[model samples]
Target: MDTVLTLAADNLLSPLILFFALGVLAALARSDLTIPEAAAKTLSLYLLFAIGFKGGVSVSGHGVDGDLVASMLAGTVLSFSLPFVAFAMLRVTTGLSVVDAAAVAGHYGSISIVTFVAATSVLESAGIASEGYLVAVAAIMEAPAILSALWIAARFSADTGNPVDARDRQGLLREILLNGSIVLLIGSFLIGYITGEDGLVEIESFVVSPFKGVLCLFLLDMGLVAGRGLRSSAKHLRPGLIGFGLLMPVVGAGAGLLGASLVGLSVGGTLLLMTLSASASYIAVPAAMRVALPEANPSIYLTMSLGITFPFNLTVGIPLYLSVARAVGG
Candidate 1:
């Protein structure tokens, strides 16, 4: 417990989190600080490429094995199933309609790339080594939740009038699978795997040396976006919704820990898996929701995922996960 608190405090004070705080504060105070959209997009691309490539390189060295296959399978199951749990919880805890609940559930079930990156950064800072294949796990986790959410809506909701046409459904599938982030991440991962250590040597300075700094900047933009959401969407977030946002990550992390234990992941790998499971997708899920379930409220899902869960995961949840991993993983 003490170790958890210490790590949480250290994380809270880290430059990345602090920069994020600065953006939130600036947004709240209306200070007009903003990252250009194009620059933010470039940063996003850089991060995906770097992390994916590094993961590929790691896998190249480690080679494919049963453990990697098992981890990927476990991650897919969690991604497909977690939305059901989240949907049930939402139905019982909040007044969200079946469609909205399913939409929001998709966010919880899908993985957040930024949050995954943040957890990796925390692990690196703490000198913990995790599996590189987890990046592939993250990519695998992104789409299944959308499928589950659609299934839930079709099965449970009788009256939304099918906002998604067959054409829209096909487009949504493409968007979910071929989103810019996923494409860059998986493509770069393959490139790195092919190039291996020699590639890393050639590009270490570009990807490795500047990673933390780039992450700090990206997080600042995220903070600003979160702050604006929290500021403007307070009306949509009732007490039940607020509680759900805060509660679901812990629930997801517990499910992840169970999966990690089953797969016999190491402490660092366990923490990363927990973090991935606990994260909510603000990127791909929302776009899918917009196309597939256009009636659902973006404010509710986006604010819950980005404004509340993302910050909590960064500031407190990651440390607790690390502590729990250390205790159980040993």
Candidate 2:
């Protein structure tokens, strides 16, 4: 408990979190502070490329083995299954329609790359080593939750007026598979793997030195976006909705812990897995939702994922996961 509190405190005080807080406060106060859209996009690309490249480089050194394959399988199972858990919880606890619940559930099940990156940063700061192939795990986790959500909506929801046909399914699949973030992540990972240690050493100054600074700025932009969503969508945030938003991540994390134990992940890898499961995908899932479930309320899912859960994970969930991983895996 003390270790968790100490780590949480340190994370909350870090420059990345502080900058995010600043953006949130600025947005809430209606200040004019903004990150240009292009710059924000560039920062996101750079982070994805850097993280993916490093993970590939690590894989180059570690080599493909049973552990890598096992972790990937674990991640896929978690992603495909978590939305059902979330949908059941929402049905029990909240008044969300099946479509909305499923949409929100999809976000929870999908991995948030930014959150994964943030966890990596935390692990690095704590001098912990984790499996770099987890980047590939992250990429693999993105699509299954979305498919699960669509399945749930089609299976349970009575309102099938806007039913997704075979063609629609094809398009959604294409979008998920070709998402820019996934492309850059997998592409960079392959590049790094092909180049190996020599590639990393040559580009270390560019990707490593500026990583935190870029992350801080990107998070600041995220904060701004989240704060604005919260401010505008306050009316939609009922107690039940808010409760689910806060509670679902912990539930997801528990599932992740089980997965980690089964796969025999080390403490750092366990923490990363827990973080990935706990995170809500504000980026990829939301984009997919906009296309697939247009009737589902964006304000609800977006506010819950980005405004409420994202900040909570950054401030508290990561530290708590780390402590738990240490206790269980250390």
Q: What is the lDDT of every predicted structure here?
A: 0.93, 0.93
List the candidates' TM-scores in order.
0.98, 0.99
Window of ten residues with lowest summed lDDT in model 2: 156-165
Q: Give a tens-digit lDDT track for model 2, residues 199-255.
A: 999999999999999999999999999889989999999999899988999999999
The model with the greatest lDDT is: 2
lDDT of 1 by residue, 1-330 (tens): 799999999999999899999988988887788999999999999999999999999889989899999999999999999999999999999999999999999999999999999999999998899889899999999999999999899899996685577787888888878888999999999888899999999999999999999999999999999999889997998999989888999999999999999999989899988998999999999988887888889999999999889999999999999999999987
RMSD of 2: 0.8
Candidate 1 TM-score, C-alpha based: 0.98
Off by over 4 Å in 1: 163-167
